[model samples]
Target: MEQLMEYLLHYVWQHRLYGLAPLATTDGQAVDVIDPGVHNLVNSGPDFFNAKVKINGMLWAGNVEVHERSSDWFRHHHDTDAAYNNVVLHIVSAADAEVRTADGKQLPQMVLSVPDYLQHNYQALIDEETYPPCYRIIPHVPPLTVHNWLSRLTVERLESKTDRVQQYLHRTGGDWERAFFITLARNFGFGTNAQAFEQWALTIDPQQIGKHRDDVFQVEAFFMGQAGLLDDTLVKAERRDSYYMRLKSEYAFLQHKFGLTPISHAQWRFGRLRPQNFPHVRLSQLARLYSERRADFSLLTETSSLDALRALFRIGVTNYWRTHYAFGEESRESDKTLQTSSLNLLLINTVSPLLFACGRQRMDEDLAERAFALLEQLPAERNYITRCWERAGIKAAHAADSQALIQLRQHYCDGKDCLRCQFGALYLKQGRS
Candidate 1:
């Protein structure tokens, strides 16, 4: 077993799963645990702080230390560290040595008695090959339990996204509009090209783009040019269409005027992607969005209804893009408008998180609530993780549920952090019963 299994021992101790039978120290003195104390500490001290226990009818309250073996106390140099001076109890899986404080006072030691079934169950979980070790038991868990867990997970997922938004805000010197633009640009890539898009956004100064926001053509030229899509060699070797020529010329003037450098065109991925989602097409749509909305995306956060948010993102690329997915390649006439699914994705991954972060920064609960409410208004995402949940009989009804499942899969299930997950804890608790 990995050394981290000690965390499972910590979990068992915290929950008092060692049964109600009278406990004893290695010396055979009767013992009782009144309180297991706080196990989660931000700073280093003891494994658990401020514990209350009764030994031989005497109540003692102090810090508690835990280890896989009692000798770890010395191996960890607690014998010389004055920080462990007041430890009242030493709980270890095996008591192989005597422990003492810096003052030479022998500390009481107890061999934590975990139930046999709990040990077997934990071993079975760790040895299981499935994504979620307890997948077989998921369907058996109470629906209310699953529902409550998912709700909490949804908040956790949103908070995680909001954390990234805060990082962007910090990098942009707390400029909300610039941060939102960066986030929106990143999300416009959907998934395959998200990093490249984010890198592109970081390179371009949003203030420069704001200057030409009134002119869609100029905005498109600037964005496409900075993306390196209007490379002289590539554009020249291709069709050299009139629109392409204009963008090349405009970008040449803007490049020198602003001292701008374009990102490598190779950063974008086109493998297996639909033409509508091509970098060229998405950049055009993003240009139109900026031209229409300008630097003020506060309207996105202030919207009262989901429909209003949907309407705000209901934009399409220019007429030239309607026939061309790339700079020169002409295609059949089709409306390259943002589809409902793509719009929902952008709202979920970009707009909602941005609004949530704004609300948190500005202390506006209504905006954060609206951000969460918007997720509930959209359909659940269909992805591999969600499919796994569905196979386990946990069907998501909305984006909130889908996001929560993603959090659970990525953070808890995949990491094998069952000891910290409520659902995993519930399953283990049921097994003990």
Candidate 2:
């Protein structure tokens, strides 16, 4: 599932529901059918009208090309009645032979005629292994439409973020301080390192660490000690040894100063990652960020972009980390810069949602917009869910569609509740009328 999310965005974007023909009365009055082609008219779903659609003055709707055999509709028991009665159209991408309704009514069948434009667009997105469709799709999307769509998406993204933050507030019994600590911890490693960081925080006592803020060294010691970097004397053989030794003594003094509990054997992994990304270093940086910036959660609402958020988090590492990755000083340059990508992930996963959550509480539009603008500039995400649609022959034209597809899949397809998705229902109504 973790791996799938990494590439699902692109797949879902391509499979987005295109528009369907709207229902109409013989006298031209619009009639809402069991399933309307609402999304299709918006160019967001399969291009068929629906079951029970009137073609050439005759009411017709039935399945087109759902994967199973025609009889499977009966096997799935659509023959049992209501599903059959409203079906005016039948659509299929492929068919073994002709199909009919359970009552022996001859249904109008329509095979999908995926536009050449759609096919070409889809093929272009999936062929490359690196650099997702963003670069390619960006050129094709109209600049005007891009801005308009992003403006809307930015709002939607922020609203969603705000909702999550509210829930966190409730879950934590409305303690802003605890929430801030959690938020800081979450930002420590961004997405990939977030869970580990959270676990590290959970194992350490917050009260013990909170009291030592006056001496920033004590705060640094608590975090490093909690991270288990001060355990071995042999670890001192490296240049970082001196730094860790000082931090260990400082933490010991601070722990006694504030009755702090020592950290246990918490799991931290450095394998397959660059040295700069080590959990120990990241935890140190996180502590430093908090010590340097003493603002309430609401202060972040004022930040305009992910870069601004990064600037907030960019407290220089302790004197030790400046010279060494673990405990050894290096002759060569070790990357001390916080990764922008990691910060972006923090905005996407933690900051944006939390900011939006805060905005909802205060009903602040500025906070919402600020959080959303950060998301808009992020490169379009690609994932398995998006690829499935790409394989099915639709293409993502922009980040707006990609995010929408992700939302659709997470909220609709995975739930097997197409009725909730305007696009999915439109697709099913046409594709499996």
Query: What lDDT does each candidate get?
Result: 0.85, 0.54
Please give, for residues 212-268, the per-residue lDDT of candidate 1 as tens digits.
889999999999999988987666565888899999999999999899999999899
Instruction: List, residue by residue over 330-429, the lDDT tens digit for candidate 2.
Output: 5355447566656555556666667666666778877655555556666555678567655544454544455655665564455443333333322323
**RMSD, candidate 1, Å:** 2.8
What's the true lDDT of residue 418 in model 2? 35
lDDT of 2 at 188: 69
- Inter-residue clash pairs, candidate 1: none
Please give the TM-score that candidate 2 achieves against the real structure: 0.56
Which segments of candidate 2 are over 4 A away from where they belong?
A: 1-173, 202-211, 233-240, 294-296, 305-307, 329-331, 381-423, 431-433
- Model 2 residue 280 CA deviation in Å: 1.7
True-structure lDDT of candidate 1? 0.85
Instruction: Give candidate 1's TM-score.
Output: 0.89
